[model samples]
Target: YSLSVAYQPSDDLNLYGRYATGYRSGGFNGEMFGSNPFFEEKVNSWELGVKSNLLDGRVRANASVYGYVWEDIQTAKIETDNGTATSGLVNAGEADRWGGELELMGAVSDSMVVGFNYSYINGDFEEFPDLCGVDPTIPCLDGTANAVRSNSPGNQYSAFTDITLARLGNGEISAFINVAYSEATPENALWSNLVANDVFPRENPAQIMDQRTLVDAQIAWRDIAIGDGMLTVTLWGKNLLDDDYPNYSINFGALNFITEQYGDPATYGVDFTYEF
Candidate 1:
């Protein structure tokens, strides 16, 4: 395990940093491990940040940036046998990731508080070849020089806002709404090996995956007695609009391809619990 810490010297001016490392396991694909073997992957990540409370503790803000490098990134290797993806995880050579985040908070009044957050991320295989084309008719991944994996996205961003209200006597009721946004991203960094003879329509979505904006809301009621015990419940819903956008794409080379992706469908659920 990686050991690191963050230190804040003051309430008005705060600073912090951290260092961490993680491992990715190596594994064989049941589809093709019989003929091919694969290897494992690893990564090292580091980050730093600063936070501040301004306007006499009414306003608060924080910002942070991070970087990471991976050794022997596990990659999927495909073979000509039925064009099925069967190779195990192989060292993907190397890869890296870096990003930053900013957030702000404010106390509008004694009864209400508001906050906002934003984040951006950029990741690249750095060494993967762009053998995949831009058209929609590309057949299965060509075993040719064009064949590559590591389709991670290059740019991603998100924004969110939240609000909280004071509670009531026996039980408190607070409502919140949060909206988030993200830039389009590549489905994968490597050429798909789904079907051997299949030429993927496009290595990724015909274009960058579509950007998306999601809105969610929640209402929580807590600290109430139910019968002989205390009980609480939350009514929550996500993607309330049920916006239809592509969440992912598949390109098996020319043999098979799915250009459009199906995003999450809208749903609402309730959580209820009682303590004795």
Candidate 2:
């Protein structure tokens, strides 16, 4: 079920609110773990937001705050027994989340524009208990609510600015830059702990992906006369700073080593197109 409301107090401003409920169907983890499946998960969400244009249409902004609760969340893990490993899913208990976002765009002039966006979220498991390992004597089951939810980033931000430099030969030349940042994130319990202080002293004691920033740039010429059509040309570079950040990492306890994947390095490309 869901509900929503909207109000416009002036020609330049609008307010809105919403409440919604959703469900996610759980399923088996992998063929290695047959016949067993995780339970479904449900969530209830609420949001309040506003949109406005200020400074005589030169600036526009949108912002929202939201909260949600998750029930019977499905979680997955891998287990090994006697040199064979299998993946399985289970119904972890409840969790709650809250977040907010703001987006702003401004026209510094008719020839230049800038935009920015930011988001923050905090989520955690409220109740969960599961086996820590294959050994029954290890006493892995414990009732605890302190586990940090997987894949939940606490903060993220991005911004972009574009400017039209000049007009020549019936075409406009523009340049733009984009930047993005993300806070460190918690790692999965499975691989994160295998290479902790007890094992790999060089590795992080708490499994986490370090904060990273990425930048991109582009220059383009548009509406150039080409025979009977218009032509556009663009030169672009991605990951311009050549940041070498880990895209993924895992510590295999059984193997006694950690593996990591790195993001793409700086790359450049050019594109040309003709429009009829």
Candidate 3:
């Protein structure tokens, strides 16, 4: 269910607020428990935001703040059960999350434009018990809980700019550049290798991967004539600087491992499109 309200304070400014509720159905983890299903999860959220035009419509800005709470959050874990590795999903407990975002764009000149955006989020575990342990006689709540939520990054920011380089006969050529960055976060609640060894585990806050930054750019020419049709061509490259960062990492006493899930390597390509 959802509800929203909006107000136009001025001809160039707008404000809004919203409230909503959502849910996710439970599912089973075939890797560890073929038929046992976790409980469904639900969330309630609220948001308030504002949008405005400044500098006589040449500049635009928007910002918003939001918060939410989750009940019966489903979390997954990998463990060793009787010397066999297994993965399973469980209703870990509850969590509270909050965040905000900001964006600004400006037409600095007739031929160039710039934009900036930033966002931040924070999540906390209310109650989560370890269901997988070495001692079968001990209760699940005996020193088996977590404070931090997995995969929750605290902050991120990005910026982009586009410039019209030149104009050709009945066509125009433009170039653009964009850059993005993300804060580091925990890859998982427990280190995989330790859990696989049948030992009770706790996530180490100090053991974190480094942050990431990526850059990309593109140039294009459009509205060229091909007989009675129009043609456009574009040249582009992503992750242009080839910055290397670990998307996943683990420390296993003697061995350190990292997986580069930063996506494909730096690549450049040209595209052609025609319209009649």
- The prediction achieving the highest TM-score against the true structure is 2
Local accuracy by lDDT, each model: 0.64, 0.78, 0.76
lDDT of 3 at 200: 46
Considering every candidate listed, which one attains the maximal lDDT?
Answer: 2
- Candidate 3: tens digits of C-alpha lDDT, residues 1-276: 999999998989999999999999987778657788898999999999999999899999999999999888777654444455556777767778899999999998999999999999987776666543455564443212444655767888899999999988878999999999988887665433334444344333334555778899999998999899999999999889887766654444323433335456788999999999
Candidate 3 ranges beyond 4 A from true positions: 82-84, 136-147, 191-209, 248-262
How far is each candidate from the true structure, as Cα RMSD in Å? 5.5, 4.1, 3.2
Ranking by TM-score: 2, 3, 1
Per-residue lDDT of 33-82 in model 1, one digit per residue for the tens? Answer: 55445556677889899989999999898899998987776654433346
Runs with alpha carbons beyond 4 Å of true place in candidate 1: 1-7, 55-58, 77-80, 83-88, 129-169, 192-208, 259-261
- Pairs in clash, predicted candidate 2: none
Full ranking by lDDT: 2, 3, 1
> What TM-score, computed on C-alpha atoms, does each candidate reach?
0.74, 0.88, 0.86
Residue 211's lDDT within candidate 2 is 84
Against the true structure, candidate 1 reaches a TM-score of: 0.74
Q: How far does residue 149 in candidate 2 sit from its true spot (Å)?
A: 2.7
Q: Which scores better on TM-score, 1 or 3?
A: 3
By lDDT, the better pick of 1 and 3 is 3
